[model samples]
Target chain A: MVLRVLRSMIGLLLFVQVSVASAVLDIEIIGAGEHQIPIAIVPFGGDDLLAKTINAVVMGDLQRSGLFRPVDLAGKAPHELSEVSYPDWQARGADALVIGSVALQANGRIEARFRLLDVVKQAELSGQAVSANGDQVRAVGHRVADLIYEKLTGDKGVFGTRIAYVNRQGKKFSLIVADSDGYNEQTVLAQNEPIMSPAWSPDGSHLAYVSFETGHAVVYVQSLYTNQRTVLADFHGSNSAPAWSPDGKQMAVVLTRDGSSQIYLVRPDGSGLRRITFSGVIDTEPNFSPDGQSLLFTSDRGGTAQIYSVPAGGGTEQRVTFGEGNNFSPRYSPDGKGFVYTHFINGKFYIAVQDIQNGQVEILTAGGWEKKPSFAPNGKLILFASEARGRGILATVSSDGRVQQHMFTQSGDAREPVWGPHL
Target chain B: MKKLVICVLLVNLLAACASEKPKEVAAAAPETPAAKETVAAEPAAVAVDPLNDPANILAKRSVYFPFDVSAVQDADKPIVLAHGKYLNEHPSRKIRVEGNCDERGSNEYNLALGQRRAESVKKMLVLGGAKASQIETVSYGEEKPKATGHDEASWSQNRRSDIKY
Candidate 1:
């Protein structure tokens, strides 16, 4: 009877010690405010090649969001959960920590096990294991981002998507597809004439762009895999600014064979040539809304350059922009919440966003001459053109005005970038 | 007879004095700014009819080139002189220039070509005596077909520059 009583007392003492350790862990993190939930990514444990690759990718993903600042692991590493000194983490200002290890398991399979902790809540957020080889190290890193994103943003993350853009090298123009990080660039079309606009089809299997190969701007849709190309329209006038429909069956472009520069719609098979607008002035640069209900474009019918929207089937157009200077290139957000456009006023151009409801213009950047704004698939990042010093370069900003990333084509000039659909 | 001869001489001297006095009065008058303004506004106004309502209500402004070239036209001498005179006289009148194409090219190419046309006009207004700040230009390209049908008569109308008040 006495032994049983002593055993229960010992168990209670052990529980108390564990609770005390957790309390210390919570108190040691920085800015783990009421809103800022803490997480922990423990030092990656593995050998040189595998460890270096995984750690670098994981760190790169977290740092890009601008919402996350990674904690460095050094020789003062704790041997186990018991040896994890809460005071040291508190000094380092880590609200949370992730302890993970990567190694080869049975059957020649590589496995990575990761554990998440809410240092302040004194609880575990998540502990997960993902199986992948070295070839998939980059993808696994994205999965880690997804895991962290859901915990922090309360929304699923889409980090697996790609971006396609027009790259100009010397006098040569090419349609280049690359990973969003500006890596693994692949050329789909290499042509001498300038490629104006490159838009991804709804299914992402094909791309539609304007090429000046035939001495006039013509819309051509081509499959990325097989390189099968078809000219959508090479009409009598300007066949320019091709925007794909949500279903990818038809494309909208600007043609003036009738009288003036007016917007027209053509099928993927180049059968129908229907006029969508008769502005009696210039109307071009049409972009389809994600739901395919309306088309937005830049028109001078409003007395000056302004953005206007018309139904996809054609109807009364409404003025969407009402600022002093001219606005061009209205690319709607994937979620249909807002749009990004090139705002020109005061002898300068900057990217501005106009909410579909209030029509309020929010200037996304200042001082830089920005044009051809494209939204990231997640609707959290914006890519646009910024001229730095003497030349033009590509720049990005997070939707919330937090993150900014510089991207470019090594081929010289990377212009008119459109982030592909969520992968 | 001697008295009659003296009377005739006196009448002849009086006529000579009257003619010389009027000639001297005309020579003494200085050229007024209004005269200069009228002189300046006349040539531009003569280029287009004033009663054409919208077209000539404000003398139809145009972008000028030295010869027949599509390059951003430079106002050699006369157009600038006319634009300056009109601006100085009609200070409150805001002028808008609508550029046109001769219907020789496709619609999109003509639009760009017409824009270059209007830009030439804007540059002239700025360089000429007119205030660079007051003028605005729009390129109708080949859309506002000034003339219907496919002949030179229609093409001439299509290539014209209109002055809008």
Candidate 2:
């Protein structure tokens, strides 16, 4: 009977897979912590299949975080709170222990209950239960992971957030949205021409991106829920680089219709055109600050590409980056303290973050064609695009540069990653 | 005016042939008439259209630029000037200048750089006598590449401004 239930649950999960046979992005960690938290997640007992699935997910999430090291249980797992032997976990050098159980309710739903324990104190830190259908098991797992992460780190977990990126397979390009862990990937928009620079709306309901379907680069805003898209900036010349303001009321775009490419702000519905940057040289790639008072963008007016900031209402520009290397694609962090940008130096590109207050710079990733660094809503991880094995892949590094992870697709290149807002 | 000058030259040669025909008729009349007719048609068939001629500078449509540079080079200026002259002569003709860039750096910044490349060419065309209204400029940025390789050889070709009539 348990085997039958397991088969049915797996079948339901398979049915929920995206239409394309897209292999989930395989993640490889590098430069993880030297002193990781030693934790043990005992296998849950009831409804064996569901419990195992949830346990694996929670364990995987914590391990991928590079902060926790799950101890080898060797098949000895206690499911109930009373069954947990604190001495066993302490003997195994575990600082924390997680135990959970799943049971099939009478209404055909699965009820998952979990307890997070502090092995040192031999006391239960937190306990919770969640109910979900077979189709929602994966979501419940992510939620459980989120709860565990929050309880451990004192920060809200980003496991439940989504990411949007541009995937290139040969001549075809697609805008894909996937779970924060790179699972359940769905192609939101696919076309033969290039689709790039996907910026999620502040509310995470829509995406503003550049599409070349009309034979030239044009900006469009599309609703994720309704699949409806409106042409935001299809000017006479190239209309590219659409960035959303914090209020979601306006978008800043790069247009060449008026002689040279300049940054312009337009309403989401394509009205109220206002020019922002007045540089005669290239001024593009505009991103709004968290407060929407200033705009950060790349400009070559000083002869080399550098990041500059101008008031959102259009005013004198202030150079933000100064150094030997060129800086581009600046994105403001969630806290608005500083921004992360792609810096080119010594023939290689690296992701670097700058402090707005002190003008100090911290180089995050090592180097190599890294572009489009975006901060996760939690501001813990910075997602960017880098080449791996000669193919473009999405990668993330902890903001502190302690942990690094690379997410690779099976057959194509994935670039231009943007973390969606917390929904 | 060049076409009209060729037409006038052809007419003058025809008149000279006609005037000489009477004297030729005194020697051999039938052959002289056919020869005159052939001579009258020869120049018209051989006259070349400057725009379509391979030797004309206007035939060169692309202007290449150095890496990260949008200023039109001295060598490519003549090609732009030739097109400018042609556009000036044919006031009704319209041309579009499309700028492109090599695939490097930020894509949006490339768009602005490509536009600068195209506008630089457009500015020269205007200076060389073409009206601003007769010229339209657009930048494909790094999106449209003439060559797809990752090396300098391909990038040099990709960084260009193409004039299309």
True interface contacts reproduced, per candidate = 0.00, 0.61
Worst 10 residues of 2 chain A by lDDT: A9-18
Which pairs clash in the backbone of model 2?
none
Please tell me what DockQ candidate 2 reaches. Answer: 0.41
**How many clashes in each candidate?**
11, 0
Please, what's the RMSD in Å of model 2?
9.9
Cα misplacement distance, residue A240 of candidate 2 (Å): 2.2
State the lDDT of candidate 2 residue by residue for A117-200, as single tens digits: 999999998898766675566666777887788898887777767888988877888888877777767778888987878999
**Model 1 error, position A76 (Å):** 5.8
Q: For all the predictions, what are the DockQ values?
A: 0.02, 0.41
How much of the true contact map at the interface does candidate 2 reproduce, as a fraction?
0.61
Off by over 4 Å in 2: A1-21, A43-56, A103-111, A131-133, B1-60, B86-96, B127-135
**TM-score evaluated only on chain B, model 2:** 0.71
Q: What is the TM-score of each candidate against the true structure?
A: 0.64, 0.84
Q: What docking grade applies to model 1?
A: incorrect
lDDT of each: 0.61, 0.80
Top-scoring candidate (DockQ)? 2
